[model samples]
Target: MAIPLSWWLTVAAALFAIGLYGVLSRRNAIGVLLGIELMLNAANINLVAFWRFITPQALTGQVFAIFVIGIAAAEAAAGLAIIISAYRRRRTVVVDELDTMRW
Candidate 1:
């Protein structure tokens, strides 16, 4: 079975758009982090799809995806730590309220 490139791109684009909206509209630090993660995942999906349909020679996409997953994990960990620290300092998780960060 084969999948169409257009369909895959469409799905990836939708996911990226949703992530962008989440990042733009959400006010919580965790929500923003989640949006960023979603955007990264969407990018990974597009990269894999392109490699599968267009390249089809090497497993570079898979390797790239693995690296992306690792990076995303690290990003999530760091983002969580920052969010927690911000919450501790500001007593709020709202993005707007984080303007004054005191460590």
Candidate 2:
């Protein structure tokens, strides 16, 4: 019994929706980061799923997914570093409270 492409797409779409909601509803910096991560993962799933169903012989999908993972890791690291620095100075991780740069 092989899994269907539609199923994969459905799952990815659901994940993307959840991630979008998380990004919009959360008031914390870490929550936004997590939402971004979820969205990235959903994109990777779609890329690999399409590649597998459309061109199994090509390595493009897998390669792109790997590249996306690397980029996500780098983004996470940098975002965390900035969040930590902000927390150290502001003492709050709340998005609303961290808006010191807003003129």
Candidate 3:
């Protein structure tokens, strides 16, 4: 017996909600990045689930998920690099503390 699409959707929705909360509540740059990653994964899950249930023959959803994964990897790399540089300069990874653009 295979799992239902609704189960997958429910899991994805829960993950997305948790990630959203983390992004909004966390002050650390790394934490926020993690939350973003989680959200991306949730989207991937939803895409795959829909693809499997709605159109198993079409590879569009899998392709889209792969693209999303690639983009997420790149985003995480860039985000980490920026965070590391900011930490080196300011010695803190907190988002509120990195406001150097203010005049």
TM of each candidate vs. truth: 0.92, 0.95, 0.94
Off by over 4 Å in 3: none
The sequence of per-residue lDDT tens digits that candidate 3 reaches over residues 4-57 is 999999999999999999999999999999999999999999999999999999
Q: Model 1, 3-88: lDDT tens per residue?
A: 79999999999999999999999999899988998899999999899888988898998899999999999999998998998788
Most TM-score-accurate candidate: 2
lDDT for each of the candidates? 0.90, 0.96, 0.96
* Deviation of model 2 at 58, angstroms: 0.5
Candidate 1: 10-residue stretch with minimal lDDT: 94-103
- Per-residue alpha-carbon lDDT of model 2 for 13-55, expressed as tens digits? 9999999999999999999999999999999999999999999
C-alpha lDDT of residue 21 in model 3:
92
lDDT value for model 2: 0.96
